[model samples]
Target: MSAPLLQVNGLVKRFGGLVAVNGVDFSVAQGEIVGLLGPNGSGKTTVINLISGALPPTAGSVALQGQALTGLPAFRVARAGVARTFQLVRVLGSMDCVENVQAGLAFGTQNLPQRASRAQALKLLERVGMADFAHTTASELTYINQKRLELARALALRPRLLLLDEWLSGLNPSELVDGIALLRSLREEGITMLMVEHVMEAIRALCDRCVIMNAGSRIADGPPAAALAEPAVVRAYLGDDDA
Candidate 1:
């Protein structure tokens, strides 16, 4: 809708004659949260990779604010105002929380030393409620803290579109609530987000719209309540598993 801030059309990805994502299409608009849901191997991560430019699609089109992004590299994509986070929370194990976030900031900058200063890094940590953990070693932090660190890092890019993969995987109920609030605040700040998640409550609470993928293709697309109630969606991704 409204000429999506980021658009993926007929996206296809293959590996050794095996198709991972098959003609999938989706879009994320300015200030909206869209959920991408599917079971394991349903092509959620593959689709995110195509959008984030970590992997190229075999045939399809990706557009950012209506401009073609088909051939851009990952950094180029980030420069275009799209940021992605890994499902496993990629942080520097040796670096402190602040430093980990600073590395991410430097990524979208035009010019910066390979390393960032502690002050700059702390500022990012502050944004994610991690300022107190500024000096905490990544490996020393708990699982939820690491996820917050990942969010701080991603925010360093000041992206218009944020791609998140399984961001809620290991969070406790309270952590999920806090993380969802952070995402909502980002959306209010006009950041568009597309997330691939299995947490039903998070999806229902956070997303304005939903896209359900089955067999590498879209099977349902609509408001969360509507999509969740669809017959195909129940059978494929949200059925008895939710009940």
Candidate 2:
């Protein structure tokens, strides 16, 4: 097998007395969608932030294709082909959907010309199923549409790796189905993803593997079926009657 697309080794993050993420190690292969699963405060988000350079790790390293990214700032990480969406969707509220995506295209890995950026942004919006809302101001979008807009903006980065934080959190049944379909399409295009998601059905449908965490440490790393079935995972996340 080829080397993993992303490698994180002995990753650690501490905020004062709190060890938010303990020595986590995982690797994601090219084009694979890996689920980062855990209950609340399991440090899943902290792990994501550390990998993406939103927060520097207290110790250890993160590398992509053997290139170190551990201590780089967030913009440096983005320029290195890592793009992420937040748990709480973030967009330029005053800008129209298309313009919001344009900002990404302008400052993303590859800087595009203004006209080309505009056109490409529209295509990205189309990819996320938000083309019809291109002219709408971001503040006008509903919660799900805001999520789609965030996806479009992230895609504008033309990333090799995508980090999605609870992208499926608030969808109704229909929207959830559509969201799943959208993610599958991205996977088909060979986009690698490490998703921090609570939706079990989405995890089962989309993740080729899962890494489960608890109390800031990794507890299980394997296929979702086997990992989710682990007694420790059940006790930590799925709720054990014995506890």
Candidate 3:
């Protein structure tokens, strides 16, 4: 009934003569977890970059709750209540885990006082299962732990929209279960998310709907099972060796 939380219309990106994203359009509703599924080089990440202001769109518009966001810098996007994790998890390697999260809180949408920020950082680390390693140097953390820490830092931004770029990339089976639970909890707390994931099981378990892309275009958009079953989607992403 209300306007969607995020709207992207005719979005395009070009690097010289190559059009990385071509007239892609999608909308994410409040409290929805929408999965972006595509084969490699289908421009999924480019779409995320455009939406998050990491890359400027060559055409079209991006808006959050009717507030225009296209062409704004990445930091401005973050301050506009959008937070994202990278395909490669990034952290302040020299700093302790809690301190890394503290930095996110200090410079986020709603900056907090030093003491309050530290307390909040600890709470966030706890939520991400990193509280036990609060004092560990970030560079020393295992890859999976680094992913959790990155998530905590993103949460510190206090964002209404979270863009997750392959957050489920390197988890074991047990870790996958825990990760799914954490995501469900965030959903319960009302964080709208746009996730780029290759893992079909996670998509089926977590997504209310999915948008399937190929060659810089959207070929299917609907419930995960239905969209994934589309003949075109199968050819684009899910066929046997050859569709």
Stretches of model 1 off by over 4 angstroms after superposition: 110-117, 238-243
Model 1 TM-score, all chains together: 0.92
Identify the candidate with maximal lDDT: 2
Write down the RMSD of all candidates, one decimal each: 2.5, 1.1, 1.2
Tens-digit lDDT track for model 1 on 1-243? 267788889999889888888898887778889999877888889888888888988999999998778868999999889898898788898988877877787787645554545566677788778888988999999988888898888888888899999988888888888888988888888898999998989998999999988878888888999987888887885567664
For model 2 the TM-score comes to 0.98
Question: In every candidate, how many clashes are there?
Answer: 0, 0, 0
TM-score of each: 0.92, 0.98, 0.97
Residue pairs with colliding backbones in model 3 are: none
User: Candidates 1 and 3: which is better by TM-score?
Assistant: 3
Q: lDDT per residue, candidate 3, 1-243, as tens digits?
A: 999999999999899998888999899999999999999999999999999999999999999999999999998999899999999889999999989998888768566788888889999999998889999999999999999999999999889999999999889999999999999999999999999999888999999999889988888889999999888998886566666
